[model samples]
Target: MDIKTAAALHRLRLASIPEALSFPALLIFGTGFRIAFDYDALVMPLGMLHGVLFVIYVVLLLDVWNRTKWPVKRVAFFFLLAILPFGGLYGDKVLKREEAAGVAAAQAREEGTVDA
Candidate 1:
C-alpha cells in the first residue's frame, strides 16, 4: 500500500488495540472493586466499546495485511498481539519503526540515491 494509507491504517491499528484492551482491563478492575468493596455499578458500556474497537482492529489488520503484502506469520502476530494486554504497545512500536523505514526508502527512491 501507499505510505499515506499505510500510515492511516497504522494509526487506526494503534488506537483500536489500546481501546479494546482497556475495556477488558477496566472490567476486571471494576469487578475486583465490586467484589472486594461492594461498589458495583456498570461497566457494560466500556465492554461494548472495547468489543467494537476489537472488531475494527481486526478489519483494519486485514486491510493492512492486504495492502502491505505482509507474510502470514507477520499478520498472525499482529492479530495475536491485540488479544494480549501489552502486545499492542509492542506492535505499535514495531509498526512505527517499519513505517518510518518504508517512508525513508520511498524518499530514497524518489531522490534516486538508494543503493542497489
Candidate 2:
C-alpha cells in the first residue's frame, strides 16, 4: 500500500483499538459495579457507552480492512483481539509494525533504493 493509504489505515486501526478495548473493560466494570454497589446509575450509562463504542469499533474495523486489504488471517486476528482483554494493545503493536514497514517501502521506492 502507498504511505498515505497505510498511514490512514494505521490511524483507523489504532483509533479503533482503544474503543474496542474500552467497551469490554467498561462493560465488565459496569456490570460488576452495579452488582457490587447496587447502584442503577453505574449500569445504564456504561451499557450505553459500550454499545456505542462497539458499533464504532466494528465500523472502523471494516473501514480499515477495506482500505488496507489485509490478509484474512490478519484481519481475523485483529477482530479477535478486540474481544480479548489486552488484545487491543497487542494488535496495535502489530498494526504499527505493519504500517512502519509499508511506510519504509514507500520511502525506499521514492528514493530509488529498493532492495530488489
| TM-score leader | 2
- Which window of ten consecutive residues has the lowest lDDT sum in model 2? 12-21
Worst 10 residues of 1 by lDDT: 1-10
List model 2 lDDT by residue over 3-92, tens digit each: 777776577566666666776678789888888988778778888876786577667777778877879897788778777766777777
Estimate, for each residue in 1-116, the C-alpha lDDT of model 1 and write its tens digit. 34665575567557755754675587687777778888666456656667777787888888777778889999898888888876787777787877777777767766778763
Where in model 2 is the C-alpha error above 4 Å? none
Which RMSD values do the candidates have, in order?
2.9, 2.5
Error of 2 at 12 (Å): 3.3
Q: Name the best candidate (by lDDT).
A: 2
Task: Give candidate 1 regions above 4 Å deviation.
Answer: 20-24, 37-41
